[model samples]
Target: MSDLAKDAASMAKGSAGLRGAPHHTAKPLHDFKAASHDLSALGALGSLLKATGDIRDGMNTLSALTESLSEEWNAEAKLLGEVSDAFDLLDVLLSAAARAKKG
Candidate 1:
């Protein structure tokens, strides 16, 4: 086997050892029911209000980021247009110079 394959196998075995052997144990039904009930209760009207606030904040952040990106794109586009114009001017100058030389 290749060194890479051997190394991978060794790493897998090491990780398996780290996840100690599994053991079976029974949990009380009341504990499980209470935990489930508490989790559901935790998402009350207050939780909904908090989620709404978080969503509004997220939308504001998204708007700001979008505006920033748009500004950058506009600036870059303007710069690219200028560079293209300069290239066109240079082309015209070069053509004139060539014609003059030929004549």
Candidate 2:
């Protein structure tokens, strides 16, 4: 092909490529991206709230157990049980923080 013809063909190809791009036609990709980001934030927040609620419930259980054990003079057993409860709560808190940070 002649140089002029080659130039015209290349320009046509470039224009065709641009036409296929979503940005050139204002596709809904921008809105979808925003919605996806919002959903992710909501999910993270939900996870954190759930984890905190779980920890609070567990603490309440531990406190009640401790009070009962104290009346029976079972301090050693209560200490072990409370240690397990503490670890479980820590696990929830750390998992929640990690999931939130990932988002």
Candidate 3:
């Protein structure tokens, strides 16, 4: 009776159910074929192309902005030079007036 009980306990420990073994299906070939069809390389190339185009566009925009800023700076510098010349003329006139008043 103890020998039969040991056999029954061993069978129960090894089996998924009281009498049945575990069942598992194999991976289908079609699943492997689908997994092998990767487009990550093409996706990376596409992203690289888009980034290059964007960088080119940004460089163009920066060049235009730099040129515009240069023009604005030149205009401001010219205005400052004109104001300086006018101040010089005013100083000369004031000095002449002072000399005439002393005479």
Candidate 4:
């Protein structure tokens, strides 16, 4: 009798009728496949947009740096032209002084 009681107890413990996790029901295969495809598509689109935004940011930074460098180069060129003019003036003054000393 005790053996029968033990068997009954074991069966009850293992049975789904007792308190435990709920059993899962299967859905249609097409429904699962469609939802999975939609999720994958959305994931790919998100990655593409993120990459585009990164590229746009990099281009903007490059453009700003190029503009900045161009401005510096212009300023340097202007200053160098001024220095060259000063040197030409100095040469003319030296030539006049030499002529005065000789005459």
Candidate 5:
């Protein structure tokens, strides 16, 4: 069994002992208080687990976004390279035209 399951089992056992005890004694009251504190700790643990799940989800989303951005940047880079090549060809053609006109 998991550590969490073991902890929950132990907490349940500890609280169960307080159910039939007289309310007048100091030890049962102390035990009850300790059980209440344990329950509070369990609640905090639950919240922490939820927060951890949220963080995992956020990280997955960020990873997907990064991948999408990388694809887009690659495409944009290819397009820019093509545009640069076209500009270079245009410069060559214009230079040739000017030489032909002069000759």
Candidate 6:
């Protein structure tokens, strides 16, 4: 198989693994002042923010990778576009969660 095909297959397998992973819901902090006094809640918020940044970074990397691929790779472009869309949706959801937690 071509290297591109191999890489795509590997990405697909990784995606499948993500699909089966357990979900985690962050506890919403309605009051920033109250949450600031709680060490555990602060820690959780920090973790959530860090995760959101990481996801954004991953999305950027994927976009760069897609841009570097040849124009003839239409199938790969379509696949990467779907992946990018998912990342965008996730980013929006995370942003909303962060905002809700702040309020």
- Which has the greatest lDDT? 5
In candidate 1, what residue range of length 10 has the lowest lDDT sum?
A: 18-27
Question: How would you encode candidate 1's per-residue C-alpha lDDT over 15-102 as one tens digit per residue?
Answer: 4443322111113333443343344443666376666455546555655565565556556555555554555566667678889999
User: What is the alpha-carbon lDDT for the whole of candidate 3?
Assistant: 0.48
Candidate 4 contains a number of clashing pairs equal to: 0
Per-candidate TM equals: 0.52, 0.29, 0.51, 0.52, 0.53, 0.31
Best candidate, TM-score-wise?
5
Off by more than 4 A, model 4: 1-46
Tens-place lDDT per residue, model 3, 1-103, is 3343444444434332312211111133334333334434446664666664554465556555655655565565555555545555666676788899999
Better of 2 and 4 by TM-score: 4
**Residue lDDT tens for model 4, 7-35:** 44444444323222212212333344335
Tell me which of candidates 5 and 6 scores higher on lDDT: 5
User: What lDDT score is found at residue 88 in candidate 6?
Assistant: 58
Regions of model 1 farther than 4 Å from truth: 1-49
* lDDT against the true structure, each candidate: 0.50, 0.51, 0.48, 0.49, 0.52, 0.50
Instruction: Quote the RMSD, in angstroms, for model 1.
Output: 22.0
User: For model 1, what is the error of residue 33's alpha carbon versus the real structure, in angstroms, after optimal superposition?
Assistant: 42
Ranking by TM-score: 5, 4, 1, 3, 6, 2
Question: Residue 8 deviation, candidate 6, in Å?
Answer: 17
In candidate 1, position 87 carries an lDDT of 55
What would the per-residue lDDT of candidate 5 be over residues 1-103, giving only the tens digit for each residue? 4343444455444444433233334464455544543444445665776664554465556555655655565565555555545555666676788899999
